[model samples]
Target chain A: MKAKIYITLKAGVLDPQGKAVEHSLHNLGFEGVTGVRQGKYMEIELATEDKTKAEADLDEMCKKLLANIVIENYRIELE
Target chain B: MKAKIYITLKAGVLDPQGKAVEHSLHNLGFEGVTGVRQGKYMEIELATEDKTKAEADLDEMCKKLLANIVIENYRIELE
Candidate 1:
């Protein structure tokens, strides 16, 4: 099985990288472009016996390291 | 109109950050997790007159700033 983790910064967080990208786009003549937010996507392949264990493991991973609880949140999808 | 940009490292590119996250997940007892790849997603809101120009502008942005042409590729989605 495969799992995908989407990690994103929380609202009101200052994202300098995203702001820079937005500015560059506007400079490239991309008219009316506004509000750029950046996030991370991680795909993990795993072999699991059951969904319950997988969910618990994923939750633990997210809380410990997959995401920064102070500024980011993560979601996991099984495939 | 809105455009989303997804940027990912090309295959064979070594990603230390992704590897670190994977190792940490294993330590957190996420068994059988393997092969992790990390990427970036940027959501951009835009008002565009036509798809042609939007695509051109997006292409330019990707080549110049939105992505690193040497090691990363980018895709755009209009919303």
Candidate 2:
């Protein structure tokens, strides 16, 4: 099974890296870009074939290592 | 309009950050994990309402600034 994970900063949290990208885009004359929020994307291959088990493990992985729960949020998709 | 961009290392390209994450997962006893790839995800808000124009602009942004096309690949999703 394969898992796709997305880790993003929570609403109300400031993202300096995202701000830098937005600024750069404007400098490059992409004036239509009004906002940018950056996040982490991870693809993981799991040995288990069980979808339920994979989802549970992937969720644990996100909580334990992939995401900082205090300021970030994580979502997982399995295939 | 909103755009979701994903930037990932091309196949066969070495990813040290991904390796580190994989190793950490192993140490943490996520033994079912077989592989890991890390990437960047960005969400951008565009002032334009035209989807076609937004897509074109986003492609240019990826090529010019958001992605290092030499060793990375990017995908853009617009909504």
| Best candidate (score: lDDT) | 2
TM-score of each: 0.83, 0.99
Show how many residue pairs clash in every candidate, following the order shown: 0, 0
Tens-digit lDDT string for candidate 1 (B1-79) = 6777778899999989889877877777665787778888777766776788877777787798778989987888876
Lowest lDDT sum, 10 consecutive residues, model 2 chain A, at A51-60
Q: Please provide, for model 1 over A5-79, each residue's C-alpha lDDT reduced to its tens digit, 9 standing for 90 to 100.
A: 878899999999888877877777765676788888877777785788777777787788778989997888887
Q: Fraction of true inter-chain Cα contacts (below 8 Å) kept per model?
A: 0.86, 0.92
Return the top candidate by TM-score.
2
Give the per-residue lDDT of model 2 (tens digit) for A1-79. Answer: 8889999999999999999999999999999999999999999999999998888888899999999999999999887
DockQ by candidate, in order? 0.72, 0.95
| Model 2 regions more than 4 Å off | none
Tell me the lDDT of model 2 at B18.
93
The superposed Cα distance between candidate 1 and the true structure at residue B73, in angstroms, equals 2.6
Poorest 10 consecutive residues by lDDT, candidate 1 chain A: A25-34
